[model samples]
Target: MIRFENVSVTYEGADEQHQPTLREVDLTVPEGELVLLVGPSGVGKSTLLGAVSGLVPHFTGGTLTGRVTVDGRDTRTHPPRELADLVGTVGQDPSAHFVTDTVEDELAYGMESLGLAPGVMRRRVEETLDLLGLAELRDRPIATLSGGQRQRVAIGSVLTPHPKVLVLDEPTSALDPSAAEDVLAVLQRLVHDLGTTVLLAEHRLERVVQYADQVLLLPDGVMGSPAEIMTVSAVHPPVVALGRLAGWDPLPLSVRDARRRAGGLKARLEGRVPAGPDLSARPASGKQDPGPGPGHGKGLDGGDRVGRSDGTGRSGGFNPFRRRRTEAPAPAAAPLALVDALGVRRGRVEALRRIDLTVTPGETIALMGRNGAGKSTLLSTLVGMIAPTSGTVRVAGRTPHTTTPRELIRQVGLVPQEPRDLLYADTVAAECAAADADAGAEPGTCRALVSELLPGVADGIHPRDLSEGQRLALALAVVLTGRPPLLLLDEPTRGLDYAAKARLVAHLRVLAADGHAIVLATHDVELAAELAHRVVIIADGEVVADGPTAEVVVSSPAFSPQVAKILAPQPWLTVEQVEEAL
Candidate 1:
């Protein structure tokens, strides 16, 4: 269905130096097969996906030296509009694909543009709504839909056209575990029942690795079976990592496959306990210790605060079983942020309801839930971007809604879900300079942070020219320049690969040790298990479970990380824990 013949693409550069993104890639994807594209950030994953839909040279000005054919139509000869019936492409950002306000209209808009009959359009729209579980949200505005819901709608919009080949880039990056399963199931049915060819790129391999029949490694653009590619790939899911650690003959892509081969490993770790960071020394007044079991605990009050130590005082490596102690100092007179009975309303919809939360010094709290379960809304309210309909929000003892922009920048810094929302400058250097000027920091402060987060990024390049992961790093650097007491991040790891995410985990840990209170709203379970001291699960805008990381995540099947799921009944949450224990 999809074939590439010695394809190579090069973009125009200001220095008159052209660099090829895809280096003479020759590949073909069979019909009715799901091919997964895997590579590091900026290694041409998105560029390759754009080539399938004729967006590389046609929409994005560049040089196309070879041929890419989708459904027997040459992308070079046929534009995206002409090939719309044969190919459907969904990019990384779902918001960029919406052309209509409501979900129903958005799904039908593609068919309308194709000039399909009214009756046919209606039938396809209904079928797509039921297929993707978007029937209940058909009448809702696209702007109010959650990130994951928006992704589903975007996929539904394309699926309504019934193209021969479906090309998706990170389709399940923002979805919860169950929602991801639903999307994957829909893709599976399309491939099996309808003979639709699916070519997708995803950084979270644990979610989709088992579903793929073939794997395409970018830069090299080599194609092989899933097991063949995953064996030698630098990027892989945690289960594969665990398989390598245990010396399994064949690496397991899914948890079920790994669990069946874990008998001997489980016996080896029978009586071992995860030597995670010490929380016993953390100051908690009038609160009983939840111990080391998986049980819920009461939310900490304003008086109870963890100490803030320097980065040197914390453990150095990623070993989860490494014994370490937090040597942070006591909190000041007031907590960094406080929320009491917080409620927010957008028209008739209640976004947040009666939420009581506190962020003390030197603490990292992760807020997790389904896509539209008020995670983004709560972050916006805390950062003063949205006003609360009722109750109080205080950051550094000042009202967030009433605080001025200058004061708010110093009191709290927020990295929004869309990194582009925080970036406006032309070049990377200019954006860093603006961030430094806005935060009243030294000229090189923001640039240094960017270097620490994303190495080897050119300063002369435009912010939009960078990859999604690089853009996220730049946005994070811009926010961190202010060194605010309370740091708020919404879906910070959306485009980051495993290496980039590991750097982010280390940076956030240092920030937490330096006396900053961090609150992150994310769907990345592995990130929460590694970085957060406390995990808070919010459902329908209310806190459903709040406790230590192991307790909250392990108790719930939907929120647990893959490593925790593989080592069931054991309190281990990461591969490093098991590795160090053995």
Candidate 2:
């Protein structure tokens, strides 16, 4: 349904000095086929998707050299509004896609724009609400819903119009595992039963690789079947990675297929125990164990202190000085954060109820649940954004709601669900400088973190110009500058690719070891398995399950990682663990 013939896009700012963003992209997507677009963070994947919807050169103010047509309608001549009846597009930021207040209104807005029959619109709206699991949220205002909930509403709004071609960018980035599966299943039905063409771009290949009939690797513009593309593609799912590790003939796309051929790999790793997050690494002090002070840098890298001092009593963020103490800690260490019978009410909704949780120093916790299940509510409560209707929340022994922003920076820091909320500066350099000043750290602290997390990012680039993943990395680096004793991250890996995610896991591990407490409200199961020492499952505003990562995740099929599912009953959580054992 979508065809790009010798298409190339170059923005106005580029005066032949820089190469075109999309160069010589010639491809044709067959009707009724689901094509998966895969590439690194800054590649032209989003640009390619925009070409089909006519958002690239039309609305984005770029020059288009070639032609892009959808269903016999050329995108160049037909603007987004003219093509809206035939094509539906959902971008990364779902909030930007909304034009109405309530969930039901947002879903019906598209059909109303098309001037569809009122009865037909109502029927399609109801079907979409049920299909995307937005029935309960139909009456809720879009502003009051969580990030993941907004994503579903945005998708349902496009889906209600019943367009022939659907183009999605990171459709499942904000969704939980189960909700992502449901949305992908609905897309599968559209492809198989209804014959709708879908062109999607997502970094989480493990979730969508199996659903794709054809895989399109961008920048290089390589297109082929999933097996053929994965065999040579650098960015791939864990199932394909494991197939490469075990030397399997054909890489498997799904867990079931991988499991059928995993008997031998399981046998090889039968007696070996997987290496888990090191939770015993703690400070060797008998003192009150005051949380990570400005000069306290022993926790991150095996006693490699951060923040060097030039006799000013303020050290830079990273220092090469290493100091390790072998002595053990005193008994009865205090918890970094304490939540007792926490109850939060937003309007008429009980966002959280009777929740009890604790985080000691040097521990990582993963909060897992479905969409609108109050995971973000719990994070907001802990960070002091929302006051509790009942119970108490204490971080670093101070009530978050009662603490001042200046004082709270030393005690706790939060990288909110929307990463843009934490950034306001014009340039990347300015953002880092502002973070250093706000956190009272030496210069270059935030810049160093950004370089480590997202390498090759220019200092002059504007935060708004960054890709979703690049922007997220910059936000994370800004938060880490403070060296807060208690850190909270909401969906930390939303737009990150596998390579970027590996960098994040490495950095978080160092922080956890350096005596900092971390809490992640997330839906990435593989991330939880890789970095979290404890997994807490929340459902209906209550903690249904909480235990060590392996025991909690492996028991639940929905939350299990691909390696755990492939090597069944073996307690393996990641391909790295299996590879380490062999």
Candidate 3:
């Protein structure tokens, strides 16, 4: 059992700018219980774990005036590694934890550090590899893994130690929906089967809610904030959003739970719910095409030009699916370029072999693979961030290297791995306004558009003071203002809860319908199946397959199925898609 007896942490000011991260926080957790610690980034969620890990004052050089005892051992008296046998940790940035180049070695590294015997280490490593579904990658070099794969390795490294308790700080924060799910699923199983007490700090709640035995609603425990940091927001995911406008309960935790709770309300409304669009109409693969093959009177591949009022859109020569139905007509025709024919590199590391990728407007693209597969690197090249060491790179009829960051901003918006990097403004409103104005919006219109695209942003707080979920929405608000034809998001749903993630997917579905070409780099197969119009797989920096999203995900059995993928080989990004396909 873990107990925080009036836990209060105060850090010495580095300068006048130095601020406190956590305040007095009293909390407790029972043994063998799974607790989820969540709040906006920079909150005391991480500090809470550090208190138990004995890394607070000991490592951070902070003034700690609290008693954090785990298993009756005072954390203040013990060091983190000294308590390593009792607690395991998986951090948000996994790249920092690699102990060796091989997956097998990485697992062995932890046990070896603890001075475990060779036979015990071998057996533990083998069991953990299979449990985490890393058996195939066991022999693979850690240098060869993708971002998601490396994260898995980080988890395996700590878990193989067989600690009594496991603490994961934003373990899935950087993973795509499915990759996040994979990692969470493994953690859930550990708590359920092995009785490893689990404490995780997470921003994304949708996937973890169903599995959580208990939830801790942490306030922004900073020494100074709008509310003294002790006010706890609701920890559970809400079942509905705008439903409040219609006077609904609005707090359903899961789909089944929501449906069960909504039955009585549905009868009271008696069709006032507006006979919501039949989700069953979704296609088995790809979105519903009115035509026989590929829909909408478009040619093969959905390539056509379209124009925008801002002098940015291409006309009939672009992908029509990405153009607004009622907006300005497209510009004169021009040949749209694909990103294939390039080899990408990351410093001394070769991230991608030559990968040829094609992008068409109105199509949602999903990129998948093990960590080190180059999905992130490939996305950067497409968005014009990283240049290809070889081969030409083309995005929106131009090579990424040729496009300036500002120019790329208009055409390509990358939802980065860490949302904090996207935020620099003092306040959430200011950040959104800055994003809109930077994207070439007229004065005053940016704020209105930000409100329209993102819900619950105007709570009156600084962007830095908001939660990770709030910050993620603020970043999205800025990106949506430009309404670019091509949108690239690394992983849009990383730090969000289930309800939040579902809302984000709903928004993306709308974007896809409006003819916005989106390329999402993630480890989430479910999200890919749901929102991706097509799925692209990258292995060792080379694209292996690029086609319909469901088709690509179906090929990998080690890769679990999303809801739609399970029912059909093709992925279903939304529930309605499955219903429609059925």
Better of 2 and 3 by TM-score: 2
The local lDDT score (0 to 100) that residue 115 gets in candidate 2 is 95
CA RMSD, predictions in order: 7.7, 8.6, 10.4
Q: What is the TM-score of each candidate against the true structure?
A: 0.91, 0.91, 0.64
Q: What shift in Å separates residue 530 of candidate 3 from its native position after superposition? A: 9.0
Model 1 stretches astray by more than 4 angstroms: 14-17, 278-333
Model 1: residue 42 alpha-carbon error in angstroms: 1.0
lDDT (CA) per prediction: 0.79, 0.80, 0.59
Deviation from native of the Cα of residue 167 in model 2, angstroms: 0.6
Candidate 2's TM-score:
0.91
> For candidate 3, lDDT tens digit of each residue in 92-125?
5676678788989999998898899999999999
Clashes counted in candidate 1 amount to 2
lDDT of 1 by residue, 424-541 (tens): 8998999988888877787888888888777867788788877788898888888888778788888878888887777777777666655677899888998888778778887777
lDDT of 3 at 525: 54
Q: Would you give me the overall lDDT of model 3?
A: 0.59
The TM-score of predicted model 1 comes to 0.91
Residue pairs in steric clash, candidate 1?
Answer: 308-328, 309-328
